[model samples]
Target chain A: MPRCRVRVSTWRRSVVGGAGGVEACRSGEVPYGGGRFNGQEGSEDSDSSVNRKSYPTTLRRHPSRMDQSESELKRFMSGLTLAECVGFVIIILTIVWLQYYRGGFAWSSDYKVMFNWHPLLMILSMIFLYANVMLVYRTFRHERKKKLKLVHAGLFLVIFVMAVIGLSAVFNVHNTAGTPNMYSLHSWLGICTMVLFACQWLCGLLSFLFPGVRHALRAWYLPVHTFFGMVVFILASCTVLMGLLEKAIFTLNDKTDTPYQFLPREAVVVNVMGILVALFAGLVIFLVGNPVFKRLSLPEDEMLLNEPIN
Target chain B: MPRCRVRVSTWRRSVVGGAGGVEACRSGEVPYGGGRFNGQEGSEDSDSSVNRKSYPTTLRRHPSRMDQSESELKRFMSGLTLAECVGFVIIILTIVWLQYYRGGFAWSSDYKVMFNWHPLLMILSMIFLYANVMLVYRTFRHERKKKLKLVHAGLFLVIFVMAVIGLSAVFNVHNTAGTPNMYSLHSWLGICTMVLFACQWLCGLLSFLFPGVRHALRAWYLPVHTFFGMVVFILASCTVLMGLLEKAIFTLNDKTDTPYQFLPREAVVVNVMGILVALFAGLVIFLVGNPVFKRLSLPEDEMLLNEPIN
Candidate 1:
């Protein structure tokens, strides 16, 4: 009877001990088989790698979102970055060209910095802007059926329409000089661009907030979104510069002026070419620095997510 | 040996019968104990009244939730149950007055018939618009430190300021007819309204979609939202009419045409008053709606969930 009692006591003890082990496994006090610590159980060790796998760094993690990277970047590049780079290079080239072309003919301010020739530069930058927009167009080309593709198409249409009207005004019709009903069209185009840019920015914001939604498009959609973002920046800069030229820049000769550009040509071309390189560089950095790309590049880093619902 | 065999047979019979009895109970046949079915019986039908206590009729549920007799007549009148009979009479009387008086002088077609007076409607609608906006403003009043509230305030300020400026142009500034600068301000204000409204609407949409968000502000927010929606429609009607008047009434007459009131003098005021009352009534109906009122009044309906997470 004593031997039987001893056996029962041991059996009871073992059963209780086995149940406690299962509970410990559930609470994650110590990882089963992943024993980095002394096999002594009870306390939990939460590694940074494990925690990072559970929760990610995202725009939600960003402490500040109110800052409009888009608006600020467009303003900064147009007002400062492009003018500095292109202006320096042009000024150096102009001085050299002047020295090289020492004909007895004197150059008037109009001849030296006529708004008409800047139309050529405007066309060049416009082509660059068009090219940028096209990159987005091509990336999302495969996404013919997506709802967001409508947004993409609508957005590019804004820039394209504005560009068409502005080009018509600059080269063909000289609409900016206020011939008949053209200024109305120019003004309407500006309004259209403003609306389109606002919608695009909102979409971009939604994308940033919800990473899962960043690409309902394929592997190329990131490049597409990024491309349009740059194109929009380019187009918005062009629009604002055009607005400034129409309202503020050309009248810089007044005594009331703090002086914008010395010979600030408001003729559409110079207004639009002033904000590209900086946009390109900043966009590249932002794209390259994206964590999605980092993960894509380093397949091993994504291994943390391999286990299902761990 | 015969006694042992008999005892075994009786035990087997009892086990089989017990299993059948349990299955019958589980299958919901003879549910109330099924005690006598296997023949270990009591007075089987003694107290059905005791059993009646277990199943409460649907009519005996919550008093407020019940469909009461005679009070079904009140359900046809939205929110009529809450008001005293006198209040219901007053509402009916007011509706009758509105439908009768809503015409030329009562509603002030001075603003309505002429496009110039379009601002009159805008300026008037703003009084109620301000009221509705202010009510919503109070709900977010406690959330003063939130950036979204600031955005909302900015939105209101933009709309109010633009309307004030536009109305001022219509009434106070006669120079609105000629000067490009005045038109520019009008243009700027219009653009500002478009941008501000887009932002407000998008932000409002996000707040409405996210119920668990502490500052969702949706239920209290919707009446105001609908109120603004109605106001927008009213403004659009007035503005579009004004646009037509600019082309039709003002354009046709020119500086030479004498301004003449269409209707006889006394009839004018009555018509104008009628329009205003009707507009307000319609606005109110479009906002909260009768169904919402019924739900809101219910104690368990929890329409305004205290935790803001419904």
Candidate 2:
């Protein structure tokens, strides 16, 4: 076994490879083209190599822990998108199950329908649109970088509107029911996540889109922006889980004649949704975090770097 | 701005730096000494520079985002440890509040004591020991590499034992009550996390500590090991949260006379605990993810590279 001389004084590009760096160094796995370690299989040349060349040097070197190729990663991404779609469907069905089956969703019926819209819209905004915004870079890797930014910004705007509607629905419920708002943990986290999301979106707009902010400031804020986006999304998911549990508790307590002891259909639905929601969030985070899965930076990125308005 | 001629062909040392890498590149922050960020006001040369010299060349080049001195990081760590301690105390008190006040623990009584032990021991093992196991490397960064390994392995062993006791206690409660086990989502997640923890611990022991395992295998397994450790710990915490919610729901539902429409004190306590637990997990993840906060790799790491038994 020949000692792999790792030159140490290089800059920080190495660490972003993260655990892969440690693994690569220790194993001395032939750089990129060798190991079958991280589930990398299938044809290497199915897709255009544009995305591959666009990758950061570290990613080009390490690829991923999975050593995923362009075609393989695309397949994985498609599977993930499918899983996400299914999760979305499950979330919607669960809301409908809780509302329609439980006699909560009638347009003619006043406040319950409004309350029903809270969960539906919140899931739509928080889980669905929020995930799409995060995935824009990945999904449209071939598109112009500027177009992707607009798409991201546009999606976020839609999310904000949906979130606003969701918030009003909940507030309307509290108002009509004469209950104090923000009393529950669910409400507290929900409101906090929403407020933080709004702040994050506004700052992102000012720093990235509205222009006039220094390039240095935007560069500094990018990681923070990425970090908080994931955090707020996680917080929202947890808040939703708590909300489901809270609702289940209240409903169970209200029911007088039910003889069900342990596992009911409603509880089963809730549990499955909880699992799906968690898995969905985890997968999205994984894709966002992995550089191999990132959209390729276009030539326009260089142009934007030079332009003052970008 | 002079073009920072980032040497392209250098190995992936930079990405491994992560947050520190980002900060260094963006701020071009003077290696480690010149900048006064992150409360590094006093230090010029208080500690030995052995650890500094031992850092990978990339870290030497990039150092940290905040330019936090060793003493400052140590101070930050101490503060975090204190916060962790406070959080641990809060968790214990909350359990006590729930058990003693809400009626579970009675030494004089027979079966209830067994039931009470479930929550107490689970929190002790699942949250406290699990978190400590995750933090051993970070907390004792300056310790001899061998000693840190022993500490990590030792802490995990204790966690495993505690978890076994915790599981049996829950099982005992179910057996005593003639209730079915593994029924609730809480139970399912709890059991799954425990099982995964056992597998992870065993694989870790074999791959890392056991003598016959090849270095290449250990290197490949390291990232997976680190990742699963965090994942299982998080799952355990989530399981505990779900367990608490499950218990609260059952207790609330059982009570016939209490006309509690608003958030009760018990609910508030549970919610606060949930928030604290989530925040603690988030903080630990942040600390672990930030390379600047990591304990510097020692010369012993190099020595181990040559040793066949390591």
For lDDT, the strongest prediction is 2
Can you give the TM-score per candidate against the true fold?
0.23, 0.73
For model 2, residues A1-310, the per-residue Cα lDDT tens digits are 1111222222113223222322222122212211111111101221112233323345345545334333435554665666567666766776766575466654333776668777777877898678767776555544445565667778888898988887888788778878767766567668778888999888877767764566556655665677667778777877766666666656644677442246567766766676666667666655554333333333344344225434
Give the fraction of native contacts in model 1. 0.00
DockQ of prediction 1: 0.01
Candidate 2 CAPRI classification by DockQ: incorrect
Two-chain complex of model 2, DockQ on C-alpha atoms against the true structure: 0.14
lDDT per model, in order?
0.30, 0.56
Residue range with the least summed lDDT across 10 consecutive positions in model 1 chain A: A35-44
What DockQ values do the models have?
A: 0.01, 0.14
Candidate 2 has an lDDT of 0.56
Encode model 1's per-residue lDDT on B207-299: one tens digit a residue: 543346443244334434443443343333222222322222222223343321232222233233323332343333222221111110111
Candidate 1, A1-310: lDDT as tens digits: 0000112233223223222221122221211211111111111111213323422244212223212222322333343334335434433433332233212122133332333333333333333333333333222211212322344455555655545544443433333333333222123334444455556556544543333442233222343344344434433333333333333332342435344333323212222222232233233323221111111011121222223322
Model 1 bad stretches (over 4 Å): A1-113, A119-239, A242-310, B1-159, B166-177, B180-310
Q: Best TM-score goes to which candidate?
A: 2
